[model samples]
Target: MHIGLISETFWPDINGVSMTLAQWSQGLLDAGDQLDLITPHAHADTVGLEGIPWQDAKPFRHISASRVPLPGYRGVKLGLMLPKAAKRLWRKSPPDVLYIATEGLLGLDALRYGRQNGIPVVGGFHTNFQYYLHHYHLQWLTPLMRAYLRRFHNACTRTLTPTQAKKNQLLRQKYHRIHRVGRGVDLSQFYPRTTQERSLWRQQHGISDDTLLLGYTGRLAAEKNLSQWIESYQILKSQHPSPVKALIVGDGPWRDHVLSALPDALWLGELTGEALAIAYSAMDIFSFPSMTETYGNVVPEALASGTPVIAFDCAAAHELLQPGKNGDCIGVNEAEDYTARLIHLAHDYQQSPQRWRTASAKSIHHLGWPTVNASFRRHLVQAIHEVKRHGRQRSDFVATKS
Candidate 1:
């Protein structure tokens, strides 16, 4: 099968969407399927490309366009592609199915091209861009953004989201042909290490084995809802009998603010590969506070690393977490509950550390990259088959009525 992935973000961008795309591209290529990628140039985020294996994962054909840095974001950028270029590229070597990953101008242009050319276009709901407006003080434009997203996705043959909860939400909002396709974790890279190994790593970093190390790994952004989580951590630290410390990973526009908020934290900025896997293993607990995430890739990644997670009952947590067994999945906006859960988990860990180690290993072992990539491939094939069964005429593509 030949697949076309159109997105504003890709490899080296250091985000959930890009990471997932990279995984899918590599998996598909390994399976003997062809893939064409269209995204912003890696030079847009020069630093991000340093450790990323951009040379290893090669797609069939790659297309890049001009990009401008997004306001308030350091390395993030929005891609700009002309319609003529898109048409010309596809006319020469078109793909069997087109997957639109981002709701930016580049994705929209590719979507339009696919629709006009009778190609099967599948939209991916990866990020909650509409909800992000609240963090940027553009709440007034949220409704407009929401409507635009709905229309854009509805126009596609099928829309794929990472979690069942997100699929349900889109369905309630009248989104057509919504499907649930999950994200996966690389267990080989992110899995449990021995207690002695963890102890040695912690000791080297000046962290005691007895102290509870609460951590957050992802982009430090306003929409991530980091500040509230930091506050909850502070509250947990003060009230809990056990000693607690923080380990902050990743960097973004909110880096300075997070630094100021958690001055005593071990701030290791943007770790990858083995370094990133070790960081997750060192943490006693992983807390994800972002209510705006469509999937929250960190949840499974943390669980895979044998680090118990604490997250709001939304997104991936709504599906993956089993409260008290695997990790605490508190209700959204319940700040007190979030703090209380952290304290409770910390106490439980101190009493029986082995229990959490066992739970973490068993929690998300089913979410390997092979299973996710296969499911995604099936969806793309389904879309292609649908287009073929029905004619390519606009009237024949009644996805909205489906």
Candidate 2:
């Protein structure tokens, strides 16, 4: 099958959407399918993807759309509105299925073109854009955003959500044809390292053996609710006997703000590949307070790296994390409750680190990429078949009437 993916975010973006799409694309190609990616051009000096091998002799084709910096966002770009260009490309060589991964201008154009040409379109709900409006001080636009999202998704044959919880929320909002497809983690790349290797990693980073390292791996932005994580760390540091260290990975516009507030914390800007895996393994606990995530990719990755997590009882945490088993999932928006749990986990880990690490690793052992990719492929084929069946039914009815 020939599939076309349209998104504003793709390779070199270093976010959950890009990462998941990359894995899914590779999986489809490996399973004897062809793909055509349409995405925004990378920013100056940023790395972009090279050629990908396909079942056909021709290399994977990437159509680079023009991009401009997104308003009120740092290090983010919005693809130029290009309905004509998209229409031209699709009309020349139509795809068997079209998957829209974002609701940005680029994705909207592709959705419009595909619908007009009688092509089956599948949408993926990856981000909580409505929740983000409050963070950006555009709360007034919440209703508008929700209405637009509902209309956008209802037009697609099926809208794929990362969690059943998210699908339920969309159903409550009157979204149509919503499907649940969860994310997966790379077990080989994110598993636990040896005790000696972890000790050496800490030594290299100037962390003493006794220090309790609490880590946060994602974009440092206001919408992420990072200040709550900082407050929780402060509370844990005050109560715990062992020295406590905060390790922050990834960079965003709020990096300077976090740095000013917590000057002593270690900030490792955007570690990828093995470096990211090692960082996750070296941490004693992964602290996340964000409530706006559709699915927190870091949560499962942390668990796979043998590090327990402390996250709000929402989104992926609600789906994956079990209280008092692998990690603690506190009440949603309950700051005091979250902080207390953090302190308790810290103290408990100090007593039995090996047991907690083993439980953490065991929790997410089944979230391999192959299972996730297979599910995605099945859904794509199902949508295509449904659309074709409906089309045939409509044609037969018209012929009978004539």
lDDT per residue as tens, model 1, 1-402: 988888888767777888898888777877798777777764421122334543354426666666898988877778876335545766887889999998887887777778877899999999898999999999999999998899888889999999888888899999989999999998889998888989999999999988889999999989988977888889888987878899999999899999998888999999887889989988989989889989989899899898889899999888888888778898886756777788888888778777986798789898888889889889999999999998564622233321
- Model 2 residue 318 CA deviation (Å) reads 1.0
The 10-residue segment of model 1 with minimum total lDDT is: 393-402
**TM-score per candidate, in order?**
0.93, 0.93
Q: Give all candidates' CA lDDT scores.
A: 0.83, 0.84
- List clash counts for every candidate, in order: 0, 0
The residue pairs in collision within model 1 are: none
**Model 2 Cα shift for residue 160 (angstroms):** 0.2
Candidate 1 global CA lDDT score? 0.83
lDDT of 2 by residue, 1-402 (tens): 889888888767888998899888877877888787788864322122553221233346677777889865676888865435555766788888899998977777777766766778899999999999898899999999998888888888889999988899899989989999899999989999999999999999999989999999999998999889888888788889989999999998889989888888999999878899999999999999999999989999999999999999888789788877778998885766888888988888878999999999999999998899999999999988988888622211112210
Off by over 4 Å in 1: 42-56, 82-86, 393-402
Candidate 2 to truth, TM: 0.93
